[model samples]
Target: MTTYNTADHSDFVRQLYAFAAHIRDPKKNPCPEALEERRMKIYRELFYNNVESFISSSFPVLRQIMMHERWHGMIRDYFANHLSHTPLFPEIPREFLKYLDHERIAQPDDPPFILELAHYEWVELALSISDEKVEIATINPKGDLLDGIPVISPFAWSLSYRFPVHKISPDFQPRAPEATQTNLIVYRDADFAVHFIEINAVTARLLQLISSNDHKSARTLLQQISVELNHVQADVVVRGGMEILSDLRKRQVILGVRV
Candidate 1:
């Protein structure tokens, strides 16, 4: 193996980082004087355009709702400032979600539901591309959901947002949060189709319970929720929850009992 001089290696690494920084934010950082402007221009456009395209596809609705200047401005900020942890193109949206969640502060021009909308869009993309697979042999599909433990699918994600992100679109963007928080479950069905449905608080709580408990029967889980709610009729809560479980099973949100 041929080893290079340590000082030369360090200088090369520094030059490489400087080249990347200029490409990432050309307005703020100048490229090396030795580099050709035409070649650097191509690199800048190619890098920024690729990132922008992935982001546009991931959050199509959000893209449609925002003005071009505002949307591209946000994307540019993410491309320039976000320290993305992944090198894969598919994971770029996840990095953008992190930037919105932690790094980028909300601006006066940003939609009130910007973060929630981005998160909602990211869930659909995540479920579609997730590698988690269910083993059919381990699950007893015919088992009684109420009498036996029910298994929530890894694809069923329970999300609670301050705004109704599912309903936001170019035509119906709300300016303020609604009267109540919006609860939703986004899941992938047997056909590999991803779907999102608005759910009530009770249904969201039931999904949460199914996710956390491996031994509790559906009836027992419902009873716990009833006690938490201080409901006058525990039996009524159980009955309602059982019906909801059956519906969720039909949707493939509950994969079956852990048998």
Candidate 2:
């Protein structure tokens, strides 16, 4: 058996750290002298490529809208910095979002809506892979949305952004934030397909109420919203809320009323 001294073990650990550091950021960290340069080159490329590929897939719309060099540079920054909380590959998108949200320093050329776009794309990926299962039988498919307690699907997410993230693509990247905030409900249907619907502030608030309350009927929630809105004709608000509720049910944002 080969017995290693403490000094030898310390040196080996230092070398490992150096190797990882260099792989994460060759421009800043020096490669370990013990590493073969040719082999290290292959290793570094493989590791960076894998991280870049995962991020690229996770934020396809963000990738599409960004300049190629800028996008890769951002990925390299993420690869070199953000320490992920989980080891799962499926969680990389969430990790990347963390990097974007807290780690990254924005660049002059980067889109104003970059973070929102990345988040929106991440939302779709999250809904597709989420483990939360919805039981259709517990919900009444034909129940009156206004009379019965409206049930927001576990897979449905109500999101609000300063930019129209869903509308972002290579063709239309807004240089500045929109005057009004964009509200969206992204949901996974019975077939497990992720979809998004743009909604107004009232609709967003109604969904928020549904998510927070289990005892309130849709009509009750809408009436509260009308009072909040200070609408002169509360009945008009309720009628509009009913129409939106019916539409949301069809879209799977509201799965149905609870049994």
Which candidate number would show the highest lDDT if scored against the true structure? 1
- TM-score winner among the candidates? 1
Model 1 spans > 4 angstroms off = 1-11
lDDT of candidate model 2 versus the reference: 0.87
Clashes of each: 0, 0
Worst 10 residues of 1 by lDDT: 1-10
lDDT of 1: 0.88
Local lDDT at 20 for model 2: 82
TM-score of 1: 0.93
Residues 1-259 of candidate 1: C-alpha lDDT, one tens digit per residue: 1123235568777677767888888998787777898999999999999889989999999899989998898888888888876789899989998999899878987889998999999999999999997888889987999989998888889999999999898888889998989999999997889998889999998888888897889999999999999999999999999899889899998888989
